[model samples]
Target: MGVHHHKIGGGKLLIAIVLNLILTVVQIVGGIISGSLALLSDALHNFSDVSALTISHVAHTLSSKKATVKETFGYKRAEIIAALFNASVLIAIGIYLIYESFVRFYDPQPVVSVWVVGLGMLGVIVNGGSIWLLEAEAKGNMNIRAAYLHLLGDTLTSVAVVAGGAAMYFWHIYWIDPLISIAIALYLIYASLSLVKESTGVLMEFVPEDLDVEEIAEAVAREPDIKNIHHLHIWRINDREVFLQAHLDFEQNLSLQEVTRRIEKIEKMLKHRFGISHAVLQPEFMRDDEKDLIKGES
Candidate 1:
């Protein structure tokens, strides 16, 4: 199932790259001819999108490699690494756009034909198409979703640039050029910050948002033979793979095999109910409760 989902994600990323490359060329030429810094900045932003999509494609391919003896987890972390790289690129682009917008605000430049502005409107349409193509897969994967949001922001910025161009053409209000650029920069900041937060959370191996640790402890404690549960740990190896480890104290006089059966049941229950597939339960006799299964803890 993981491999199937990744293949779909890779296909979507390839489509996005092709569309974005086409749009970037169009925007660059249109921006240069029109002397619109807003259009030019957006073109550069799309160029960054191209890089981001490429990274996502490579990461998806690497993530599907079978596990080797040296690396038991295989290459799943490649996707997470790619997600972090994408977020970093977003931050860089956002900062550069913000700086350029400030520079243009102080020295606003003349914008040319409304025809060039019309070209930018076409860019908005293309970006919208790219967003729709990736939106379905983004729901299940963060890396692709970040790329989608970036394109979405660029699409909106293209609309703003077109509106600003139309205003300037009809009214000779050159200041709208810098104003539109500022709006695009702000949008980039908003979207990039969200991407950074999500990527960081995943890299930190935080518990999956839907699984509450306290609730899990309570559930395990409810087992008929369980005396207590402690030293519980739950975290994700990636978005889809969750790992849990804990010490299970069994009631006195339970056979070893019986205790093993109970632990196996708990593992199955966790997988079925909470999406946790890799769980390690260490059973301890009630008399040995004072001794710690995990060393180096007080």
Candidate 2:
């Protein structure tokens, strides 16, 4: 299911990648000729969009590959890795923009407002279209969301450039260039932080933020003939797929057939209640073991 979904995302990413690659070159040249720091900052941000989209495209492609014995989970996590990489780049670029803005604040340079306004208008159109293209898929997929954010940030920066250009043209307020750059940097940092936190949490094997182990155990305990559930662990394979493992103690020394039927019911309960995609439960009857829900020295 994930592979098919990624295949659809691939087409949108390809279009965005090509568009951003072209826009990056145009913005860089335009920024240089216009002497607009804000325009240069937008160009740098656009370049990151190109790189991020490319990474996402590759990840989507890799995710479509079948699982092998060597890599049992397949490449579903490729998109998660791409999301991490994109968010990290966003932070680095944001820091760089802020530093550049401080330098510009000290010694503001005069810009050609005509060139700045004209190129910034073109940027708005290009980035806006890219945002529209990716908006539908961005809702559910973190990789797409990061790429969408790159385009959204670029759109906002382009708007800022247009405003700054007007300000410079009317009042000769050169410092507005740095001010707009600073605003763009702050926004990028704010937007990228959650993606960075989520991706890092997944990489570190932390339990998914929305899930509660105790709540899950309590829910499962409601089933018939269940003595207790313990030694339970849950984690996500990606944004959509969650895997669980646990020990299930039974009240009766049931037959193998009865145990299988009971286990099937519990699996269904987990799937319906918790959205767990895979479950590996160890069934036990009248066996002595550590009964803690979380079985480890705390």
For every model shown, the clashing-pair count is 0, 0
lDDT tens readout by residue for model 2, 26-66: 98999999999999999999999999999988987887788
**Candidate with the greatest TM-score versus the true structure:** 2
- Residue-level lDDT for 156 in candidate 1: 85
The lDDT, on a scale of 0 to 1, for candidate 2 is 0.90
> lDDT by residue for model 1 over 9-29, one digit each (tens)?
888889989989998998899
Cα deviation at 90, candidate 1, in Å, is: 1.2
Lowest lDDT sum, 10 consecutive residues, model 2, at 1-10
* Candidate 2 TM-score, true structure as reference: 0.97
Every candidate's lDDT: 0.81, 0.90
Among these predictions, the greatest lDDT belongs to 2
lDDT (C-alpha) at residue 135 in model 2: 96
Q: Candidate 1 local accuracy as lDDT?
A: 0.81
